[model samples]
Target: MRGLFIIGRTTAQSIPTMLGIIVISFILLHLMPGDAVDAIVGMSGSASKETVAQLRETYGLDQSLPMQFWNYLSGVFQLNLGTSISYSAPVLDVILERLPATLTLMLCAFVLALAGGIVIGWAMAVFAGRWPDRLLTAGSLLLYSAPNFWVGLMIIVLFSAKLQWFPSSGDESIGAGLTGWAWFLDRAHHLVLPSCALAAFFVAIYARLTRAAMLEVLRQDYIRTARAKGLHPMLIQFRHGLRNALIPVTTVAGLHLGNLLGGAVVVETVFNWPGLGRLTMNALAARDTQVLLGILLLSSVAVILTNLLIDWLVTWLDPRIRS
Candidate 1:
């Protein structure tokens, strides 16, 4: 019952938050300088006023702001994100087509970061005040602060250009179809560079957070009592301290998951990957309002859902949170 109540409250809060985001996004998009029609038509000097007006009418851009908002809201409820001005396909269709590639890349990167982070963090905690901990801490800080684009460029220079170990761009081989182990292996090979680029920042963050949390837990009365009872160091750390440290890591990881979905824009663009981030970038350049709005809505929903899942997990992991 307590858990259900927390969920209910969270849902209620999220409703207003999503609505606020929509309103702010719409206004900010509209307030940006330059005419959307002019952008679509290439130039005002070449296009006549009549042609521009027609384009505006075609996209319902001439409608009152309130009416436009109402229409968009209604379409969202009906799962009709409308047709993209640039692509001529439904916005949802465009999003669905590009989503899988992004998800696959993100999932692989997330798994790598999560596993690597926990192990490194655990080692640091166990070897606290030792050279290993100091080395990892220093290395993580350097990687965390380095620009992602620069790291990507270095990876390409070494692996793709210098060694010729991996392809420099695109998600898959030209001849590899979207099936079979051969195709899968090719895709995974391409994934290596981009995933590593994405995981570097996450690795630093998770290691730091986990180390801090574990250090705190290790000083707790229970940990001290366990050590006093002559429990093995590995057992005491793994069986007791690790679970408590996970609570903070869980929160950070959950928030970063949502951020990764949207924040992959730079990484995706750098790699020339044809994911939603790239698609959205193209749509923005073309002033394709439908596609832009569709991507924004999808990202917003993903963030909300990820956070909600984390909330539920917190309740499950620590019953006190339900209270």
Candidate 2:
């Protein structure tokens, strides 16, 4: 009951937050120099001034900014996200088509980051103040500092270009018509590189965070008590130390979900993955306001919901918070 109340309250709070995101995104996207008509004209090679004027009027781009926003807000209330000038479809439909791909990529990267970070961080913590810890710390710093795009390109160059290990650019093999495990495996194969690229910095961050958190937890009196109880060192570290240390990591992960989506824009572009991130690039290129706004709104919702979940998880993990 308390959890439900917390969820309800958090969700109620998020309504205004979402509204602000929608307003800000709409305003900022509109303020950009080009509009759907300009992008259409460019795509079509040329258009008469009269044709251009008609295009703007057709898309209601000729309306005043305030009027446009009002109309958009009205449609939003009705669950109509407007139409994508580039796709000639409802913005929601266009986004839905690409949503699964992005979700898959994100899930893969997220899991990889969390699992790998925990393991690596555990090792680092166990080897604290030793050469192993020092080595992992330096490596984490390198990964954290490297640009996602640069790391993506390097992975493509080495794994794709030289070693022929994995396909560098795509979510799946086109026209393979594979079924079941074949299709799943093929998709996973393609996902490996992009997921790694997307997860590199996050892995570094979580690893470092976990290491610090574990170190702190290890210093607590409870950890010393566990040691004095004659518990196995590994069991004490895993069952007691790491479990208590995960609260901060979980919170940070929830907050970083937005940044993960932002990074996906570059990763998808680099990998040519058919996800919202790639779609976002295409929308920006074409000045597709409807699509851009839809993506932004949906992303905000995802982040809000994720944070809500994180709150619940943190509460469950640490009873102190409930008090």
Winning model by lDDT: 2
Segments in model 2 whose C-alpha atoms lie over 4 Å from true places: none
RMSD of each: 1.9, 1.0
- For model 2, residues 91-190, the per-residue Cα lDDT tens digits are 9999999999999999899999988888889889989999999999999899999999999999999999999999988878989999999999998899
TM-score of 2: 0.98
In order, the Cα lDDT scores of the candidates are 0.84, 0.93
Candidate 1, residues 202-293: lDDT per residue as tens digits? 98889888899999999999999999999998899988888889898988898897668665677799899889879978887877776777
TM for candidate 1 is 0.94
